[model samples]
Target: MRRSVAVRLSALLATGALAAATGMALSTSTASAATGGVTGYATQNGGTTGGAGGQTVRATTGTAIHQALCGRASSSTPIIIQVEGTINHGNTAKVSGSSCNTAAGVIELKQISNVTIVGVGNGAVFDQLGIHIRESRNIIIQNVTVRNVKKSGSPTSNGGDAIGMESGVRNVWVDHATLEASGGESEGYDGLFDMKDNTQYVTLSYSILRNSGRGGLIGSSESDTSNGYVTFHHNLYQNIDSRTPLLRGGVSHIYNNHYKNLNESGINSRAGARAKVDNNYFEDSKDVLGTFYTDAAGYWQVSGNVFDNVTWSSRSGDNNPAGPNPTSNTSVSVPYAYTLDAANCVPSVVSQTAGANKGLKVSDGSCTPQSPDPTDPGPTDPGPTDPDPTDPPTGTNLSLGAGADGSSKASGTSYGNVIDGSTSTYWSPSGSTGSVSVKWGSATKVSKINIRQASGSGTVNSYRVVNQDTGAVLASGSGTGVISFSATSLKKITFEITGASGTPRIAEFETYAS
Candidate 1:
C-alpha cells in the first residue's frame, strides 16, 4: 500500500501553513541571581523570579509591550505581559539601561531582566515586525506568531529576524511559537530565530518554522565561539530551504524534532560546533546532518535518528555527510535531566504540541514549584490532545502504472518509477528539465496529483499539467506542493517540468479521483 500520505501531509501542512522550572531555597535575591547555581534548563534562568514575584500585565499594542518592559519596578523583578492583539512595533526609542540601540520600529526587550511575553485569546501576532533581545536575562516567549520581518526596506527590525537575541543574554525559553517568512535574504527576509554574541542557557521547545529560507543560527561567525549550551526539542521544520539551524560553535542538544523538505541543507554543524542529535525525524530532505560549503568542520554524536527518503551529497574535502550510518567523534554530556520520545512519535507529538494555541504541555525537568498564572483573563489552556491521523480526502490512485504505460523525455530513468508506491526508488531525468506522461488503458477521472521528491533537493520551480489528448492545460503552478483541481476524464496526462534547480528526481507522482 502507498505510505499513508494524507495523514502525514495534512499534519505537515496544518503546522507548516500556520516550559519551566524549579529549584532551591536560597534568599529571594540570591535565589533569582543568574549565578544562583540553578540547575534545570529553565529554573535559575530568565524572568522567573525577577520582579514582584508574579504580576500579570496585559498589552495589545507594541507601545504597551515596550512600556511594560521599561516600566518594570526593577530589572530583577519578574512580570508577565499577556499580549492579545496584533503588535505592530511603532516604538524605536533607546531605553538607557536596557541597551536598546535601534530606533523605534521593533519591540526591543533590552537591558530588562525577568519578563515573559505570551499570547492569549486568539493569540498574539507580530506582523511585519521583530523582537530584539539584547543584554537581557530570564525571558520566556510563548504562544505567539511572528512573520514577514524585513531587513532592507524601511521599518525593518533585528536585521530581518522574527526573534533575535545577542550579548549577555541568558536563561531564555522560547516555547510554542510560530516564525515564518515568504523568502530568503534576496527577498529581504532572514532567520526565523537567531542567537549570537555570548548568549547561553536557552531552550527552543515545541515551535514551528515554515516557508523560511533560513531556519536559525547559533554563534554568528567562526571566531565567535563563546555562545553554546542550547537545547532544541519537539519542533517542526517544514519547507525551509536550509539552515534548519546553522550552528557555528556551540554545544547544542537537538532531539525529537521533525524536519521535512529541507531542499538545500539541514543541521549545519560547523566552525567547531558540537551537536548531540538523537531521535529526530528527517523526511524527504537532502544532506540533513553535515558540514557543507565551509572548510571549518563541526562534530556530532548522533543516535536513533530516522532519515526517510533522504539523499546525501558526495564527500568532498569540505562537504562531510553525516549518515547512511553516522559516527560519533565526541561525546556530549547534557547538564540537565530530560526524557526522549522515539523518533517515530516526533511527527505526531510535534504536530500536536509544537505551535501556539495548543496549550503548553512541557516537561518539568527540575520539578520545581509552579508560578502563579502568567497571563491575565487567563485563557483556557488545554493539555496535549492527539489529532486524527487520517489521510485527507483521497481516492484510489488511478495512475499507479499497474496496467498503465508511461514515457518521459529522459530515457535512463524508468517512467514507471513515478508510480511505484515505494519512496526508496525514484526517476532522475538526465537534465534539469523534462516532461513525463502516463496513458491509462481507458479514460480515467483525475482530480489531484501528489508529487513526492526522493532527494527533495531538485527544485520544480514551475510546472504545468496538461491533458495530452484534448490539448488542454489542467493546472500550472510555481513551487511544489499537492496540486488539486476539478475532476476531469482523460486518456493521457502529461506533467511538464517548466523550471527547476537541478536534475529532476521524482519519487512518486500519484493521481487520484476525487
Candidate 2:
C-alpha cells in the first residue's frame, strides 16, 4: 500500500503515541479453545502446529504479553495470545518471573513452545521494538507491523531485527507481517528478519520487508552453517539496498516473491547454501541470485524466474550468476509439494496478496488452469486465399503521436519516450505522482496495455488505467507489467500512478487491440 499508511502506523506505535485501541478488548477470563492446525509448507517435515488445541488469551501492553506467554504455569500447553493495540516496550516496564525474564526494551519468547502471537482488528504494531524468538518451537507471528528497531541504540533487542529466531528454534512460521527499517548500518538499523544459531524448519510468508539495509539472513556467520530449511514465498522485498536476503548457508526455497530496486544484491546464497530459486520476479536488482563476498560458494537450482533488467557481476570466484549460466556446484531437492505462479504473473499476484492486513490471501498451490481443452480439428481441404468477410480484422499497433499523441501532467525525460520501441530509452517521471496519457483522433478499441520498465528502480507499485473521455477506470491495481481488462472503446486512455516506492521509468507503453 501507501507509504503514508506505514508512516502513520509507525507514528501511532511510537512512545507517548495516541492509544487508538483496536482489535479484541483485553479479557481477564481465559477461554480454553482449540484453533486450526498450521497450513502451507509449515505442515511438512514433522509439521508445525502452533497453539493448536489451546487456550486463547488477550494481552494489551508489552508486559501483559510477556505475562500471558512466559508466566504460563505449563509450558507444554499450547496458547494463542491475541495482541491488540501497540505493544511498544517503551510503554511497559521490565517483566521478570520464574518462567520468563525480559528487559524493558523488547518482548522475548524464550524457551517457549507451541505459541501463536497474532495481532487482531485494525492490527497490532511494534514500533522501535523487536520480537525475539529464542529456543522456541511451533511458533507463529502474524498480522503485525514492526518498524525502526535499531541495533546500535540503547534498549535494542534481537540484534535490531523486527523478528529474529535463534538457538534451537524450529517450526516457526512468520506470515502477513510488515517489517521495515529507516536506514542501514549507518542508521543503526539491522535486518528486518534474521535467523541464526541452529534455527531450522522456518517459513516466512506473505510479508513485506522494505527500506532496509538488510532484508534478512539464514545463517549468522560463515562457520555457522547449521541453520537452514527455511522457506520464503509470496513476500515483497522492496526499496532495500541489499541482502534481500543474505543466505550464508542453508537449503532455502525462495519463490513467487517480488524483489524490486535492490541496489546492491538480492539473494546472496553463499558458503555452501543451497537455494531452490523458482518463479520469482526480480526487477532493477543487481546480482539477484549468486555467491557473493566469500568464495566458500553456494548452490542454486534456479527455474522459471523473471530477471527484468537485472545487472550481474562478472563471472568470477564466488560471483556466479544464477541460471542461464550458473556456477553452483550442487542442486537441492525440495521435500514439500508447492505450486508456482509464473514469474510474469508474480508482480500482479504478489501485489494483490502479499504483506499484512491483506486478509491472508494465499494461493492454494494449484496453478493448473480449470478450463477444458478444445476439440482437435478434423482433416480439411485448403481454403480460398480471400479472407472471410464475417471474421474480424487482426488488430495492429496504433502508432503513437501519429494517429495518437502522448502527454503527461508532470514533466518526465520525454513523454514520447514511453511510446518509443527501444527498451534502452525510457521516460523517467520527476515525481511519484504523475500520469501518462495517449489520445487518439477517434475512438479505438483497446484490450491490453504492456508497461515496460527501465529497471527495477523504475517499476511502479500501484496505478490505475482510466478512460479519460468517460472518466471511467478500466483497471486499477499494483505493480508493472501487462494490464488486461475488458475491451473498451475510448478516445483517450491514461495510466495514472497513485502510489509508488521509487521514481518509475516507463520504457514503453504498448497498447494492443485483440
Candidate 3:
C-alpha cells in the first residue's frame, strides 16, 4: 500500500530549449549517498519507479537489488547489501561471475538479522565469501578484508576451515579485518574466522591472521557441556601448521599476542574447553604434537608466558597395560610448564646435544656433565630396595652413562681430584687432561643443570661439582656457570674455565630430571 515516483522536476525551469532536458534531469534524479549506508537513485527515460516511499529500490546492477531482496528479508527486517569495488577472479558480484562456483556462500545470510555488509574503498574479495552468515542473529562483520576464499574442489575430511559456522550460527563478531591465504585444500585449510553454531558471545579482536590454512584461530562444539565463548585478544598468529592445531576449544581466552612459526600445538584444548593460556609469546614454534584434552584432549591450565624456541611433544594413549604408567608417561612432556605466583617454574635448558630425548636432569646447578655419576646408593635417602649409586636404582633410565665405561675426574686435592678421561673419550687436548677431570658414562637421573654460552662458539668460566666416589667439593660457581644440585654419585664430571672472563672459547653441558 506504499507507492510514489517523485519524478516531478519542475522542467529544469525551461529558459533555453528546456536547458538540455533539465541538465539530463539534474543528472539522473539526485539521490546519491553510498559508502555502505547505501542510497543511489537515478532513473530517466523509463521513469516510472516505486517500491515507493521508503525509496531503497534503485539499481545500477548489484544483480537487480540481488533479486529484489531475495526471500523478502526478515530477522528484524535486515537486507542491506552495500559493496563498492572488487570481488575478483575477474570481477563480478551478487550471483554470476560464477555465483561462487554455482553458489554455496557468496552471501548466504539465510535467517538474517541486524545484518550489515559494509565495504567501501578497500573491501571485497569474495572469491567465495566476504559474507556467509547463515541462520543469522545480530551479526556484524566490520571493516572487511577477506581475500581468496578458494574451495570448489578438493575436499576430504578437515578440508580447510575458512568460515564454517556449520552447526547453528549464533552471536558472532569478526572485527577489524584481514584474513589472508583463505585455506581450501586441507589441513583445515585456513582460519575459519568467527564460526558459530551452538553459539555464545564470541569475539575475535583486532584481526590479521595470515597464512590462514592450518590455523590462526578456530573453535568447535560437539558438546562436553557445550557452552562456547571464545576471545582471542589483540590478534596475530603467524605461520601455523600440521594444517593448524591451535585453538581447538574449551571456553577460551588467549591473551596479548604474537606467535610465529607454529607448526603445531600452540594452544589446542578440546571437549572440556577451559583454555586460558595467558600473556603470550610463543616464538619459533614446532612440536606441540597433540593432547590438551576436553572432548578428551588433556586437562588444561598453562599461564604467564614467554616460550622462546618452544617445542613440546606428547600424544600417546592406549592401554595394553601390564607394566608402567606414571600418568600415561608419554616420556614426560616438555618445552615448558608453570606455577609462578605460588611457586614452581622451571625452564632454562637449551644446551643442545642429547638427542634421543628422555628429558629431566640437572642433579645439581649451573651444569657441566657431558656424562658422569654412578657410585652406588649415593644421592641419599636409600630405602626402597637400595641401588641408587647415581642411578640404576629405579626404572625408566633412558641410558647415557648407563651404557658404562670409566676413567673420570674432578678435584681440589685428594692426591689430585681426578676424572682420568678415556672411556667415553673425545674432549681432546688429551681428553683435555686434568686440573680436575670429570667424565663418567652411565649414571642416570641428574635433575637439572645449565652452563650456557656454547652455541657454535663457547663461554663459561669456573664450574664445580665433585664426588667421584668422594673427592667431595659438591658445589662451586663463578661467572655465568649457573648452579643447582643433589643427585650425587660421581666418578667424573668436570669443567673449570673458558671464554667470557674475556670471551673466546666454549662451554655448555646440560641435563635435567629428578
Model 1 worst lDDT run, 10 consecutive residues: 4-13
After TM-score superposition, the amount by which residue 165's alpha carbon in candidate 3 deviates from its true location, in angstroms, is 4.2
TM-score of candidate 2 to 2 decimals: 0.64
List candidate 3 stretches off by more than 4 Å. 1-125, 134-190, 196-210, 213-267, 274-285, 289-514
Reference-based TM-score of each model: 0.62, 0.64, 0.23
State in Å the error of residue 206, model 2: 0.7
In terms of lDDT, model 3 sits at 0.35
**Model 3 lDDT per residue over 86-173, tens place:** 4433322344221111233344554544443433222333443434555545444444555546554432111233444434555555
In order of listing, the candidates' clash counts read 13, 3, 64
For 1-514, candidate 2 gives per-residue lDDT tens digits of 1110000000011111212231222222222111112344565667775664455555567776776565556665676676757877566557666666566778788887877787654457888889998988888787688989988976576678999888998888888789998889888899998999999888888789999999989888999899988889889999898787788777888998999989877888888888888889999878787777778777788777888988877777656666445444577787777778888888877776677655445554444211111111001111111111132234565535533233443454777777766777767656775788767888888876777678655545446576676544454445566555556777777777765677888777777676
Ranking of predictions according to lDDT? 2, 1, 3
- Superpose all Cα atoms of candidate 3 onto the true structure and report the RMSD in Å to 1 decimal: 31.8
Q: After superposition, how far is residue 45 of candidate 1 from its true place, in Å?
A: 6.4
